[model samples]
Target: MQMKKVKIDSDRCKGCQLCINVCPKGCLKLSNTVNAAGFQYAIYENESKCTSCGFCFLVCPDVAIEVSRKAKPRVEE
Candidate 1:
C-alpha cells in the first residue's frame, strides 16, 4: 500500500474541525496545542490508516490540509 503524507498549516486553521469530521480513515484529530492564531489545529493521527483519499483536504475550510501519496519505487533496468 502507498503511504499517504499530510501537511497541515496550523497557523491558518480556525479549529473548525470540518476536516476532522470528514476523514473516513479517522486520520485527523484536533490538537490540544493551539497555533499562533489561538486556534487548535488539525493533525494527522493513525497515519498508517490514511488512504490518501483527500476527504480531509476537500472539507477543510481553511485550506490547511495538504495530502500526497508516496511514489512507488521504479524497477531498475
Candidate 2:
C-alpha cells in the first residue's frame, strides 16, 4: 500500500484555517507562532495517518497545502 503525505507552505498561508477544518483525519492544527508574513498558519501534526484525500488542499484558498501519494510499483508477469 502506498502512503500519503501533506506539505504546508507557510509563506503562502493566510491563516484561514479552512484546511484544518476540512481535514477528516484531524492531522492539521494551527500554529501559535506567526510566520514572516505575520500570519498564524496551519500545520500538520499527525502526518503518519494522512489519507491524502486532498480535502485540505481543496479547501485552502491560499493554496498553501499540498497532498501527494506514493507511487505504487506495477507487477510484471
Candidate 3:
C-alpha cells in the first residue's frame, strides 16, 4: 500500500486558508500557534485520511504545500 505525505512550509504560509478550504479529505488544518509572521499556518493533521490528491498544493497561493506518496517495499519469500 502507498501512504501519502504532506509537507507545509510554515514560514512561507500567510494563513490565507486557501489550502485548508480546498482539501477534499479534510487533512489540513490551521495551527493554534502562529508562525514567525504571526499567522496561523496550515498543518497536516490527518495522516490516515489523506489521499494525496494534491488539491491543497493547487490552491495554496504561497506555494507552501507539498504532497507525495510513498509505497512500501514488497517482501519476497
Candidate 4:
C-alpha cells in the first residue's frame, strides 16, 4: 500500500471551513493561528488516516489543498 500526503498552501487559503466540514475521515481542522491573509484556515492533523479520496481538495474553492498518493517502488528484474 502506498502512503498519502496532504499539503496545504496557506497563502491561497481563504479560511473557509468547507473542507473541514466535508472531510468524512475527520482528519482536517481549523488552525488556531491565522495565516498571512489574516484568515483562520483549516489544516490536517492526522494525515496518516487520510484515504487520499481528494475530498478536501475538491471542496476547496481557493485551491489551497493538495493530495498526493506516494508511488510504490518497483522490483528490479
Candidate 5:
C-alpha cells in the first residue's frame, strides 16, 4: 500500500504556482476557492499519485507545503 500525504498552509501561501510546476507526479493544483488572505491556494489534487518526494515543499516560496510518508506496518513471523 502507498502511504503519502501533502498539506498546504493556506494562510501563508502567496498563490504562486511554482510548487505545482515542480511536482513530478502532477498531484497538485490551484483551488478556485480563495483563502482568508485572498489568495487562491494550492491543493493536493490526487492523493493516490503522491510520492512524498517533497518537491512541492522545496519549491514553495512561501514555505506552505508539507509532504509526509506514513510508516509501513511490520509483519512479524
Candidate 6:
C-alpha cells in the first residue's frame, strides 16, 4: 500500500480554510484548538483518504501545508 502524509504548520496558518476547501480527498479540516495567532488551523484529519494530490498545498495562502507520498517497499519472492 502507498503511504501519504500531510503536514500543516499551525503557526503559519491564519484559519483561511482554503486548504480544506481545495482538498480533493477531504483529508483536511480546521482544528478546534487555536494557534498562537488565535486562529484555528487546518489539519490532516483522514489519513486513509489522502492521495497526495497537492491541491491543498497549492491553495493555501499561508503556504502552511505540505504533502508527501512514500512508495511501498518491494517484497522478495
TM of each candidate vs. truth:
0.83, 0.86, 0.83, 0.83, 0.83, 0.83
For model 5, how does the per-residue alpha-carbon lDDT over 1-77 read when each residue is reduced to its tens digit? Answer: 55349878888987899998999999988899999989998877888788799999988889887778877899898
lDDT of 1 at 3: 42
List, residue by residue over 1-77, the lDDT tens digit for candidate 6: 55448888889999988887887778888899999989998878778887888898888888888788877799999
Of models 2 and 5, which has the larger TM-score?
2
lDDT of each: 0.85, 0.86, 0.88, 0.85, 0.86, 0.84
Query: Which regions in candidate 5 have their CA more than 4 angstroms from the true location?
Result: 1-4, 72-77
Top lDDT model: 3
What does candidate 4's lDDT look like per residue over 3-76, in tens digits?
34888988788888999989989998888898888998887878778888899999899999989886779989
TM-score of candidate 3 to 2 decimals: 0.83
Instruction: Report model 2's TM-score to 2 decimal places.
Output: 0.86
RMSD of each: 3.7, 3.2, 4.0, 3.7, 3.3, 3.7
Model 3 root-mean-square deviation: 4.0
The lowest-lDDT stretch of 10 consecutive residues in candidate 2 is 1-10
lDDT of 5 at 28: 85
lDDT at 64 for candidate 3? 91
Candidate 1 worst ten-residue window by lDDT: 1-10
Q: Write the per-residue lDDT of candidate 1 for residues 1-77, one digit (tens) a residue.
A: 55448889888889998988888888888999999988888887788898888988888887888889877799999
How would you encode candidate 3's per-residue C-alpha lDDT over 1-77 as one tens digit per residue?
55349989999999999888988889888899999989999988879898888998998899998889767699999
Clashing pairs counted in every model: 0, 0, 0, 0, 0, 0
Q: Find the candidate with the highest TM-score and give its number.
A: 2
Model 5 residue pairs with clashes: none
